[model samples]
Target: MFKLCRLKYYLRNKERLIILQPLTSSLDEAFQRYSSSAADKDFLHRSILPTDHFQASLPRLPIPELEDTLKKYLECQRQILTDDEYDQTVDIVNKFKVTEGLDLQKRLIAKDKRNKHTSYIAKPWFDMYLKSRLPIVLNNNPFMYFRDDPRPEYQNQLLRSTNMIVSSLKFMKTLRANILEPDIYHLNPAKSDNMRFRKIMRMIPTPFVFYGAYMFKTLPLDMSQHKNMFNSTRIPRPGKDELVVNKEGRHLLVMRNGNFYVFDVLDASGNILEPGVIMASLHQIMQDQSPPNTEPVAVFTAEDRDVWASYREKLISLGNEETLKLIDSSIFALCFEDNKPTDPNAITRMFLHGEAGRIWFDKSLSLIMSAGGNTCVNFEHSWGDGVAVLRYFNEVFEDSTKKSVVHPSTSVQTDAASVQRLEFKLDQEMKENLQQSVKKFNSTIQSLDVHHLEYYKYTKSYVKKSGMSPDSLMQLAIQLAYYRQCKQTVATYESCSTAAFKHGRTETIRSATAETKRACTLFVDNHPAVSVEELKKAMMACSKKHGSLTRNAAMGKGFDRHLFGLKILAEEEDGRLPEMFTDSNYQKINHIILSTSTVSSPAILIGGFAPVTPNGYGVGYSTEDSRIGFNVTSYPPSTNAPNFIECVTKALDDMYEVLEGRHPAKSI
Candidate 1:
């Protein structure tokens, strides 16, 4: 016992020394100094901002050392490439690490020193997303479906619509006043501020080369002008601070019968419209059904990037200037659907690929509230990831359902006409283009399929009992399933949130690690040579490694985003992309075959997408104490989503049986 104690003591001291050695080494001098700075310490302790006053106080996303990035990149490449390709890629990476990489690093560091952007990676990230040719709906945008509202009164369409508008207006007021607490990493005040949340909240979806926001005033709902509720009498004049302070740009576009009408959600005195008035206005919208004189304009957003760009130019040439401004300046959109969904999955499916005319896939976000009070949000991933939209949904739900938030009337002029309809001037050729877009969009949505699985026999608690990280276990289960089905491990992207740093989005947590591969291989083989105990040990080690990697990513020390920033900087400075970045092996490995993220929420029923790449699966899961639910999506006729989920179900049950020495668990 004494010898064992001494051995443990030696091991503990050795581990401590290993951790401390990095601080003294020249390799990590910048990180050490930054970590020790009193100012940074103080900054971390400061309260989350009510405004952008403390924006500069947050730390910038750090650029990882080039050699380190190359090492990780090469390791990931090995999982996806042939031996010959791997060797060629290794040679390219070696050359890069010694020469061009050094130059790129210098340029990136210099840019970091000179620029004051919220994130060094933001510009390039945004540019790549906007320029991509993929259609928005399932390809690039994410959807979150909320569970059914418990209150029966919310089932009333008019009341539901009115209350939602009120709740949204309240949310905007809190936003403009900067009272909505910025989501800190783990709710830690010292961690990075999620300021990107504010940007997407009031963002407008435009059909131009770029997206922009509008300036407008919120008016009380009018019952007298039912027919004109979809019409506007006044377009608020731009103020001196229209570029920034016109926080009133919270203009919401309402979609009904494949048509759109814009309206400000707040009254002139910054008050929520009375529920009765809002109800009447919604009633008016439901009553009016106008036939199309031309093609639906929003369908153009679903076209290829270049195709849409060209059409947008044509649109501007034949533009109604007022309509263009209305589309540009609106903060966000709200779609009131006439259809009702019976289940959470149904609502999610509707939001992801709703009927074309009633949906606007180009906007930063569109809040779709069904007549039955079922709700979901479709958001553009180019602006941000799921976290930002999740925060918005949380706020709205909390204000509307969780609390009895009240707004008193100030007795301002109540009759001001605020809502307006956008009139488009389309020629015959443009109408033809719209028809083609609709066909393409429909084809894409039809090819997509979803399989919602609820594995109830085992959950997070069972995994915890086995002394394994639930997330790591889930990831391993997915890898095993894919390998069993496809007979190989390809590139996998598990979103590691970097909200711990200011303006950070996500880093790719390379889920296909060596240990995971080994464990998966053993499980698939059910090798008698490999004991269950040995497999458990391997899984636990993999889980620990994954946790460490995720924490590093949260600290802005991940590979993908950092390397992305460096590559962009190199292009700007040298007038060409580095050879290593252009390598075919590099391109092949980065094609994510599995895109997965988990958003564990009681209020959120499911969150997910259609895979970003053609032959991949998009997996969104929620692992609760009692059950594990998976929302899996893929493009069928090329990739089989049902087969993937079948493998997943088997893998999950098999894993549980192996770990717990029990009969296989059941899954649905």
Candidate 2:
């Protein structure tokens, strides 16, 4: 029996990918050698600059040929639509190509020219993300779990909690100082590459803050008081010591017992609070026996963005000014859960959409830690892509595990204020609104299904040994699995990063390629005449085609984004909906049934997203040298997640057997 592996299995087998080894004895030799070289000094001097200064100078996202886009769009639709529907789509395409689309393309070009500093499609993409009907938390946002600290001394919730907060403040300091290096792709610079990183790192705990992604109005933490750092291990017992205060909103929101609390994380002298102080304050908040909130205002975050936006305006009209500022200006949310999760699925469930009073889903990064010491982040996707969050956690993970630094004793300040609860003034009408939000949240979460699977049969090395891209092979296998189950090719959405472009997020890499369909059909048909070599060749071809599409998307020449820009301009600017967007063919292809994305981290234990559509399955996977893991989710009854997992596992095995020439051509 091929069964899914547990978190313990992953913990046992998970090996860190070490990129660099620390030098022991040659440290001075290396520095002296570098210092003696005049060329090295000159190189260092010229290479140093502000991380994101070049952001405005990067090239704008380009416009692709309209006809070629139409052709590719038709190719994608052909796999999903019926003959009559496809023909109607073809007619619509023909009409669009000769008429409004061409003029729209010209307008897009003009728009790009007018907006050289930003991508032409960036605004529309952001607006579309916010305006989309799907709730961002589970439906769109992707979350990842970092492994527990290896040091048993730091495993306690209070110690680990303070460590996470301190490390996060340190990272924020790095951002404010502009010392973090810009991210690079393909050993070359990308437009708006690091800018997205900055955006996500600073996302306010609010939805649609000022129409664009929110920037943090961060307060600084002064480290002058502590000679080294707060020791998170058992060396120093946790308790209350000194209070923390911030002038510029350097604070975190804590959601507990269906109530919200706001407090500064820095002192009056601008110094970070002692871990003991934070731990003691946390205990006080958790122990408070406040009346349980029948309806929490934060639940409004889980509502649809449009609905939330309108309701938020009503909230503003009610003049709860301080409450609004507390949510909007805070750096991020720190959600403390009362119930300790028993297993990995429970962790995912809690982190994805926690039980009542355990989540504020609107925050870009919701640092969630359960009583059992399990921790994960439920991120807001509208602000930025997953890479930014991945990078942020990488820093925190590294800082959290580093050996504790001993600091000189400092006098504790006892008179500072502790964390305070932010009470909202709600009337019967507002209470009714919040009640409706809670009902909506319950209905939505109840309808969703999540199944996390870890497949350790093979990994990236074996796929590479077969002379194929690991990512490409994984995509092909996904297509084959979907084909086996659905018995027909469906339009698939594979997120390909276009961070190579200015302010780039992602482009749709249509995974249901003609090559993939051909390969899947051949495998499923079980044609006796087909040989192992032929099957391998077809699979390799599919991978190669996917690679090409991925490259095209990376270069900002993808069909979907270009089409999206043209369509948005036609509708929003010209007040005319294009024939292509309204056609049935367009609707069929746009219905993404298999939404997939690949995110890899050396320290991350698991990562995934909720299914975008009821009938679709959202697959977030990470490929390793000896294993591959997937978190598959969908709406149950209508779409079975377990069946899809079974199909994918079977497809992987079949593909491997055929590659090794160990099994004859068999049904997938």
Local distance difference test, per candidate?
Answer: 0.65, 0.68
Candidate 2 residue lDDT tens string, 475-542 = 98788888888888887998877665566767899988889889887788655577778888898898
Which candidate number would show the highest TM-score if scored against the true structure?
2
Please write out the lDDT profile of model 1 over residues 313-415, one tens digit for every residue. 7787886666756655555667877788776466667888777666767666677878776777777666566666666677666656654322222222234
Worst 10 residues of 2 by lDDT: 228-237
Residue ranges of candidate 2 with Cα displaced over 4 Å:
1-49, 186-247, 268-271, 287-292, 309-319, 403-417, 664-668
lDDT of 2: 0.68
TM-score of 2: 0.80
TM-score of each: 0.79, 0.80
In model 1, the worst 10-residue window by lDDT is 213-222
Q: Which residue pairs collide in model 2, if any?
A: 191-502, 192-503, 239-276, 244-266, 245-266, 245-267
